[model samples]
Target: MKNIIENLKEYALETIEAEAEAVSQLPGIVDDGFGEAVALMARCKGRIVVSGVGKSAVIAQKMVATLNSTGTCALFMHSADAVHGDLGMIGPGDIVLFISKSGNTEEVKRLLPFVKKMGNPVVSIVSNRDSFLGTHSDRLIYVPMEREACPNNLAPTTSTTLHLVVCDAIAMALSRFKNFTAEDFGRFHPGGSLGKRLYMRVEDVFDKTNQPRVSEDETIKNVLITISSHRLGATVVLGPDGDLRGIITNGDVRRMVENGKDINTLQAKDIMSRSPKTVDKSALAVDALRMMEANNITSVVVLDGGKYAGLIHIHDIMREGIQ
Candidate 1:
């Protein structure tokens, strides 16, 4: 079974090669029609109505999503739904982009009457530039590829990738035109993981119970108690005047063994990390995790407005997974 699996996995390499070739062919097809499509979308006052059926339907939905996130207003109207009176989604001065690999999908053709009646420019994405939808469109963008990534060469793998890549290109062009930012992307995807990653701040993922501290005059036993109570293997140490001095950790206590100092007699200031890695409480948790990994530290001391606030351990980072 293992041998058979290894042989079968070789097909994945073939699929990758095909996908790369498909993407490489995309640049040659971009020309005046591409510029016209961008210009139409940029100037249109109404929404961009994107319609497709079958596998093309999936690509159309993603394209519309990318468009909406990158400053172009777009609505995905399913072709089956369009024929069933969903054509009302399109308004005058709008632009329609219809997607079909063969340019003759039965459901896709059903949307033509509404497209014609809307009095908007029609743009078609198809393999055959002379097919029905292609001939009717004001402009046509041809994918021109003749193969698929599947072993049978029948699946929509390569063509769908091309569709999405072209969609992303158009969206990024609009993003440059409008200066779309990360905050802008957050507006359209407020309910998903990417949205949270974009907007959720460090304060949202910070540990609230930061009750672990040891004074500079605190005994070694008291420092141990602070470390155990915090469960972070460390604690912040403060000077007699109540200002931050350094940090005390288990490793710091262990070093006393070599110096012949008594654990219970020593003060926290005798052994502590003076220059601890500090992070702002307002930074993203994901970024904090990266900092911990880069510095090879298990925890970080968090500060609020330049004041000691809390400590975050590596476990807290994983359990929260970037709020």
Candidate 2:
């Protein structure tokens, strides 16, 4: 069958190289217009309305999503639908961003007149800076693509890649100009695990049932029961004033037994390691995991107001993908 798989792999590599070459030209073309486009979107009083046709439509939708997620309010409108009453979605101060490689796509050209009548500033991201949309737009950002990855030089391959990269760049620039933070990004992705990882505090992951505790005067027999019940591999030892004293792990019990001491007579003060690691309950869950790894331990004590709050185990961090 002419080794169809190998032939396909070769063609894929060639397409990637062509697209990469096209992208290599982007750096030189990024000039004052790029900054101006970002300023326009940043200064916009209303939503950013991104419109395009065909392949550009796909990029526009993705750009809209990126913009909205990173603190910029944006919406996607297909070029064909804009003239058919979707133009109602465009507000007085909204900025219309048009994405078209050719700058003369039929659907986009047809919508440009209505776009102009709406009196909003039109910014065009087009490969041909001299084309209709390019010259007519209030501001134009040029993306000069040499050719497509298509062997026939007709399909939208490298051209679409350029469109996506340009839009991503603009969206990122807007995000930076607005000083978007990770906490701000978390607000937009609260439904996903990533949001939890970024925003979930250490206290949010603490388990009440896993609070292994013992006082200094308590017996080893009492420590064993607490550690077993809590299943946290260790128990916290508190002083007479109920302050944090030390920690005794299952290994401490084993080592005490191995030392041939009278296991029944040991107290929490005798076996506990006085220097237990602790993390503030207000710390991020990810930061707690970092402390655990750095100390080569599996769990850490949680403190609130300088008092014992609870324990955060490595398992809690792993469940959140921080490991």
Candidate 3:
């Protein structure tokens, strides 16, 4: 058992070394042919159809998904499935990105003639630049061989990472070309945690119940009753015309008690935080959160176009999601 464990550790260490080398050589591999491929994909009139078999197929799917989520429309076309009416998914003006380590997977090889007849630009990622698939490819991103991490050097670990990073490079390049923003990504992935973090508006999460407010002339005793009854530990102070003026929090009560102020006589304006932190209710929840973080605040008053919108506590974001 110990011998097996030692062998596994040795193999893992070698894998890391190979992966480092691959990452280092990625830039050099991105020149020339990579430019041609990126140009073609950027100018593509239709979608990018990724095709591969076995382990390469997984990488193909990931590339398709990343590109799709980043405003570059893409779809995965299985090599085996392509022979059976699946080729119908590919049309003129679309770019086909074929992936393979050896660059000679039989399933993919079978579709070379059909791909040629369809007149779509074919881009390929291959370990060997001289393989049959690479030879016929219009553009190629060569995955440099650093020896597999496998004990026998037969598995597809290092090569796969090399391809994945290259695919990401292409996606990121296209992302810049298309000006894909966090908002665009959020639109594509609305149900995911990342979408929640980017798209949720503050108006969607704030609570309006018992939104205690007091007039500028209200005494400290009235303020205490308002804060205690609201249970939010805070109260909004309004001006003569009902405009927001200040906020009184539990912290203010503590300060008042420490200063030995006469609670029964002091007015709300004398002890409240003037020009209190506030956010537009229509603003994204994440933006509101950032404002809170930057100001060292735990809560903010929400305003909806000149009206008292609501009050948002930091904890409310966790319960209702950022959106």
Could you say which candidate leads in TM-score? 2
| Candidate 2: stretches off by over 4 Å | 1-5, 257-262
Which is the winner by lDDT between candidate 1 and candidate 2? 2
Evaluate model 3: give its lDDT: 0.86
Where's the lowest-lDDT run of ten residues in candidate 2?
204-213
What's the lDDT of the predicted structure labeled candidate 1?
0.82
Looking at model 1, residue 310 earns an lDDT score of 81
Query: How many residue-pair clashes does candidate 2 contain?
Result: 0
- Answer with 2 or 3, whichever has the higher TM-score: 2
Going through the candidates in the order shown, the clash numbers are 0, 0, 1
Clashing pairs in 3: 200-323
lDDT of 1 by residue, 1-323 (tens): 99889887887888989899889989988899888877777787888888898889999999998888778889998988887888877888789989888898878777786688768888888888878888888878888887889878899999899988888888898788888888778777776667656775566766767647888888888888889987888899876665678887777777787778887767888888889888888887777878889988778888888878888777776664453
User: Mind sharing the TM-score for model 2?
Assistant: 0.93
Please report the candidate that would top lDDT against the real structure: 2
lDDT of 3 by residue, 1-323 (tens): 99999998887788798788778878888787789889989999999999999989999999999999999989999999999999999987899999999888889889978998989889999998888788999988887785876767888888888889989999999999999998888888787768878788887777766478999889888888998887777889988887899899989889998999878778999999998888898888887888878887777888878777667877778675553
For model 2, residues 125-206, the per-residue Cα lDDT tens digits are: 9989899998999989998887899999999999899989888888888889899999988778876777776888898888
Candidate 1: the clashing residue pairs are none
Q: Distance (Å) between predicted and true CA of 106, model 2?
A: 1.7
**CA-lDDT, candidates in order:** 0.82, 0.89, 0.86
Q: How far is candidate 3 from the true structure (C-alpha RMSD, Å)?
A: 2.6
